[model samples]
Target: MNETLAHEDLPDGLGLRLKVDVTRPLTDLTAAVNALCDQVAERRATTVVVLELAATPVDFREWPGDVGIQAVNRWERAIRRLEKQAAVTVAVARGTCGGPALDLLLAADFRIGAPGLQLILPVNDGHFWPGMTLYRLVQHLGVARARRIVLWGADLTLDKAAELGLVDQVSEDLEEALHTAAVLTGRISDRETAVRRQLLLEAVSSEYEDALGVHLAACDRELRRLRRTRDASPQNLVGQAAS
Candidate 1:
């Protein structure tokens, strides 16, 4: 079951590699989601790359009874948890990415795609699956573009995805995308990254006055740390000794 999702520790524990096969069965996908949740819970200063393999669009209607429905719900929850918990989550799309793959991509903080990347959404019996994925698309791409993709059943090319801000980078080279992700991950400490992420999330629903306190608290922490560092510097120590 773990084989369905391979986990690799990046050099120097900078992040993790989560290779997922979206074509796998619901049970396998569930296992993969569980594994990802475990990794996120660690709250390390690590970047997570969700590398997707080839997969056809999944149709939830085809799943057997309530079990399939439950799996879909659980999978979505897992992605949401990852989005909120991981210090930095990046999704890399190569080849076809649809259904579960797209869901994971939307949940990531950043996305990188290959030149041949194609994003698809599954339509069940002529009706699109109305899910949280639609809300995510709207948030990232706005209502007009989200409608075009969700209602019109339009496929997204890598270039268009980047143009719409859905993807941060578009490259034919997989290694280039990975390098970019790693660099982005190293730009901040784990604690600061998490705090900033929370600030952004709160800003979406919080007024300026309401958000000021939290921001100021974060500022105070930064200021105090800086002061401490200055006090402990060699120059400060030497001055104190001379005095």
Candidate 2:
């Protein structure tokens, strides 16, 4: 999978650029995802990013449920790790984002879709697909909305996606949107961003009081780190010091 596609470091601070032919077979989807995760870790990129609908669906004559489950598990683990480690994960989308693609897109902190982008949640194909998508949606956007999308298997346009909070914004040009994301990514402090992300997840999963405690502790740690950085800027190694 790594050898099949070329990855370019965008000169304009675009992080990593992945080019996937959406019309091709995705038998290597799992491997591609793993490679991307490795890249994210190696680069220490504040925003581990992706441009969506890069690969086309692989049409298997007979679906292998076991392989599908394994792919789902690997994807879920990778997404959780990347989301936690990266300061501001971003997804720039064009065309249709569905199935495993949608899974990856939803994992991003900010999703910017193009004018013709479409979001498809297809869990009702009269077959057993993993329930993680529904769970994540429920966790992000409440149960009712999750049910509406999962149980009914609704497909949404870019406008509806923005309205439903699925995508952050829809841009006429994808490159412009990516450039905008690059600027936004540059402005955020990694430690504070990571802490807020964790706190937000905790607030979603835990009680309010517990969430408050975690947030306050995160704030304290951030403040102390800032003070240390201010006091000792010239002493630390390059790219190893506090951001």
lDDT of 2 by residue, 1-243 (tens): 545444556656557665644333345655565566677667654544554555344432122234555655675675677667554667777777766567667777888888778876634345424456666788788877877776666678888889989899788887778777767775672657877877776676798886777878887897998998876677564445646
Worst 10 residues of 2 by lDDT: 57-66
Native RMSD of candidate 2 (Å) = 5.4
Q: What is the TM-score of each candidate against the true structure?
A: 0.82, 0.80
**Model 1 quality (TM-score):** 0.82
Best by TM-score: 1
**Which residue pairs collide in model 1, if any?**
none
lDDT of 1 by residue, 124-168 (tens): 556677767787887776778888888778778878888888888
- Weakest lDDT window of 10 consecutive positions for candidate 1: 58-67
Q: Count the backbone clashes (under 3 Å) in each candidate.
A: 0, 3
